[model samples]
Target chain A: MPTLLEIHNLSIEYKTRLGTARAVDNVSITLDENKTLGLAGESGCGKSTLGRSIIRLVPYPGRILEGEILLNLDEDVPYENGVVEKGQINLLQLDGDQMRALRGKKLAYIFQDPMTSLNPMERIGKHFVEIIKAHEPDTPKEDAQVRTKDLLEALDILPERVLDYPHQFSGGMRQRVMIGLGLTLTPQLLIADEPTTSLDVIVEAQILNLISDLKDKFNLTMMLITHNLGVLAETADSIAIMYTGRIMEVAPTEALFESPQHPYTQALLQSVPDVRKPDRKLSWIPGSPPSLTEPIPGCMFRPRCPHAMEICATEPPPLMKSTSGGIVACYLYEGS
Target chain B: MMGKSITISGVFIYLRLVQESFRDRSKLWWIVLGVILGGTIALVASLIILAARSNSGLGIPVVVGTILFGVSMLVVGLFRTLLIRKGTFSPRMGTLFLVGVTCILGVITIPVSIFILPAGWFDLWTVFVMGGVAIGIILLFLYSRYSWLKERGSPGFLTITGFLMVLSIIYMTVISYWIVPYDPAAINVGPILWPPHPGFPLGTTSLGQDLLSRTIAGGGIMLQVAFLSVLICFFVGVPLGLLSSFRGGALDRVLSLIMDAIFAFPGLILAIAIAAMLGPGVINMALAIAVVYIPSYFRVLRSQVLTIKELPYVEAAKALGARDRDTMLRYVLPNSLPSIIVVMSINFADAVLTAAGLTFVGLGLPIDVADWGWDLTFGWHQLITGAWWVITFPGIMIVLLALGFTLVGEGLNEILTPMLKE
Candidate 1:
């Protein structure tokens, strides 16, 4: 199967008061259709930054130093498959107007805080209408309204509540409303950044289920950015582990869960509380992720890695194909 | 409290009834009710006594109508705590107690005014009215204390009370016009410094004209000048401020520089310059005052606009394809209104004062127009002698009316400032 969305060698930085913050550094990932890729990282590990970079939502001062977002729309065209077409476009090369045109139709985003993402003054129905109107203004207003009402009903919200303002809805309902809005366009790839972080456990499960269901229904290639290992284990088909703006490992979910090669991945797995193994001591990942402002001489996790050696401090590990089904960027896993 | 099931629906129903009752009461109807029962009787009895002394039935209806309107307004106001309320007055015993007390006070004041002021016990009516006003102030103060302690955030009652008092004073000024008939400008070569009489009420000016006529005419001039100047200032200042804030480049710098230069100009001196340029008249004086006020309004609006411009909503609107004009007008302009309203009021009072000062210096209107400043100009000399009412009345009127505007502006500011609202 062809890769649906390819982000190659992406590096992003922003100028902050404390000097240049290397938010995302040299990250690469390819997501295939009907596959779920989880960008798992702790806070400040550039997971959100990487996700935002993919969607081109970086506000200001944050510059994409080097990258190309290559989205494969050719697969949808019957005759263009496996052909090197002329005038192949990259997303970064597109202007703001072009980006906006492509964005809700081909690319969509699920923000973490749905409350702030939405206009508080407008009704939920109005928000959907505006999104549809922006991309497809020629569509009749009455038609858009009906479609949005139907989408709201599909998302388990009452159609009567479509006229209610953002303030009238509960947080979970708002998130669902947001998710419905993001998926209403049926974009090729959906970038969801911590979509369930703000929801309760039950609501989180419902939302995750909803996203997964919609992913299959829409045949969406989803890039789910999250910190929760359990969430990734449940929802994502594949996982890319990140540590301080760099991907430490990428693999199929079950394989990675069974045998996590990267030291950081191993430490993350051990930290998760498991009810099946009640006697096993819950492992703690000692030390914090490396500060992005300072340059890492070799491995960013060298200070925290339990099996760190002298060479690990000075020489950065290159990502190599491991036997178990994926890639690992670790000196210890060179033979795997 | 004893046996009531105070459900949400019950509370809601009670609140609805209270709102309905408040909206149903008309200000005119309340005033009419007050006149038939409260102070009109006293005015009629006084009119009869005055008729016996003068042996002339000269427009008793007009005098009665004026007194009826003014006194009944107060009587209705005293009762408005119950009758003219807007929101829920939930059947609290404390509210009932307040209503009862106001009714008692209104009843007592009626008989007291009948038996007191007209019987050469003027001090009694003064004391009664002052006492009522004092009690209102105290109640307002107590309400403020409660609101502060309760952390309700807004001084809502205090604002309404302040607004009521200013409104009443403005009503008083407007109603006073009904008592006079002769045009204030019609020259009278009657005896100068004539004492109070039926023919020459409020005595005569040094010009041998009715001071009452001049006072009435002067009020009209002051209002016109203030109204016109403020309107012009708003037009010139608000747009310029919005322009500077939204387009912060060379255009902004140029607008700011011009405004600063204008702001640096002395108000009186600038009035004098415009008056000198255009020649002294009400129109010229208003133009000068408006010109001087523009800079102040511009500075205030520009600063407010700049602050609002930084807010995220502006960017969000821009991102949503809201045209620059649409964003500035819809988002930035509406948000900046409170500050603009506040500044305009202060500038209005300042405009009035400036016009008065210019006229007093013989630089505003021509010598014939009965402006408050002109009245003060011509009346101040009479002050050195024992003709104290000449300068005092017009001066007091200017100061008191300006104070009324200030109070109203402050009250409005309390309501308009979203950050300050509860």
Candidate 2:
């Protein structure tokens, strides 16, 4: 499969009264077409920031210092000078209008908080119509209405309820609506930013199933940002563990979970509650993730790494090729 | 180099803005209403001039017929469009249309009663009967059409009281011209210090002007000043508030300093100072009232915008690639309107009182114009002679109008705040 999106040497910093905080630091990952990558991290670890930066929508007080977000439009497309090839557009270099046109058409975002994501004043159908009209200005209202009804029905929502306000819907239903909205234009990439974080366990499972089903049906490339390891274990084809504004490990889901190489990834696996291992207590990683405001001299996870060595404090670990068909940024894999 | 492109883009942007605003069907009626209002004013002014100069006696009926026809057309058009949008009649829209029609008729009645009405054909009793019957018919029509209003219970006590008070003010303003047995400005029309009689219900003023007619006529001028001043405050203050809050830093700081400086002084004192400086006229009085009330609006709207700008929906709009202009106009502005509306209603009461105070101090409209404040000032000495009607009736009208606005403001606050929460 062709690479759908590639991020290289991405760094983002947020200016605060205290100082500049490096929210995302030198994070690089490649997502294949029709593939789902799970980004798992604790709170304040910059996972959400990374997801937003992919679309060049870093909020105020934050700036993307350096990065290249290359999107491949098609598998067989060739790059040409000055002309935007089928799949070779660098999103970071695009102007405001170009970026706007790209969003909700080439890519769409599903926000974290479903309750507040929608405008309170607008109806569900109005939201859909606006999105459609913004991109396809000449599309007839009836066409948009038909599409909205079709999408709502596919999500098991009543087509007539499209005229209802967001407040009229329950949390899980609103989340489904959000998903439906994200897929309205059938964008190539769907960025779900902790799509099920606010939902109940059963609803979370159902939403996860719906997302996977949609992915298969549409052949979509997805980046699912969540802190839940169990959710990632079920939904992701490839998993990338983020720690303190940096990627700690990137591997296929099976390889990463079965033979987790990085100490952080291993510790993350141990923390997951298992039904079979009733006697085994969940072991937690010691110490908190390093604050982004203060620069870490070496590895970001060094403070919490049990196998920390003297070199780990003095020298930054480079992402090295591991024997288990993945990459790990740790001193343990430096020589191997 | 940049200036040239900026100007070129600016023209296109403005054109696009006009195009988008015109696309909204509801705005078309406002434009039509504005044109009609201007035409009516021109027609009425010419008719008034003709009546004052000629003995033909044709100008009054022409004015009356034209105004009646125009107003009825406006009402019919508004109701048709409103019904088309909702597909069912709404009590709120009906009430608004009725109020507008009443105001238009009231203004027209002023000239009609002065020149057209026969000497003894119409009186206060006749006006009351006509008004009561009109109101009854409207209520019956509404009740039959919207059965839900009856089932939903009686709205609220404050809301109903507020609605009735406002309706009464409109009624008074409309029928003031034809409701009196004698002209309100006719001196020596009755005995001095006369108490309430069948001909002069509130008795006659010290000048022998009918107190009841004077009180009724006072509604039009008082309401006009209050509404105009509040409107000026709304237009001036709301945009400044939205801009400063949206574009903070230097602009916000400067605006805050200016508004705070104005806010520090007592509203009435500031209005008095401004009114005294501007000299006595209706426009000057309204301008004075508007100047004092602007800071209140500025503060209310700025705070609302500050909070609303942080909502997740605003961020979502940005993520959806909506421009800053679109986000501000569609999301921030609409979300902040309910609170601003509540503030405006509250300020309407303050404006009426302040305008009256200015008039009482001889800085309002000329004494020839029938104004409650002017009547109060002229009737002050009559109070000593125990001619209570001279001062009492005008004073009551002023208090009643203010109370009406206050009740409406309070009721709107109750209704709108919960809707915002939802």
Query: lDDT of each structure?
Result: 0.68, 0.75
Evaluated at residue B380, the lDDT of candidate 1 is 84
List per-model TM-scores for chain B.
Answer: 0.63, 0.68
For the predicted complex of model 1, DockQ is 0.11
**Model 2 per-residue lDDT tens digits across residues A96-126:** 7777766777777889899888777778898
lDDT of 1 at B103: 57
**Model number with the top DockQ:** 2
Best by TM-score: 2
Specify the poorest-scoring 10-residue window by lDDT in model 2 chain B.
B7-16
| Clash pairs detected, candidate 1 | none
Residue A31, model 2: lDDT of 94
Worst 10 residues of 2 chain A by lDDT: A75-84
Residue B420 in candidate 1 has what lDDT?
A: 49
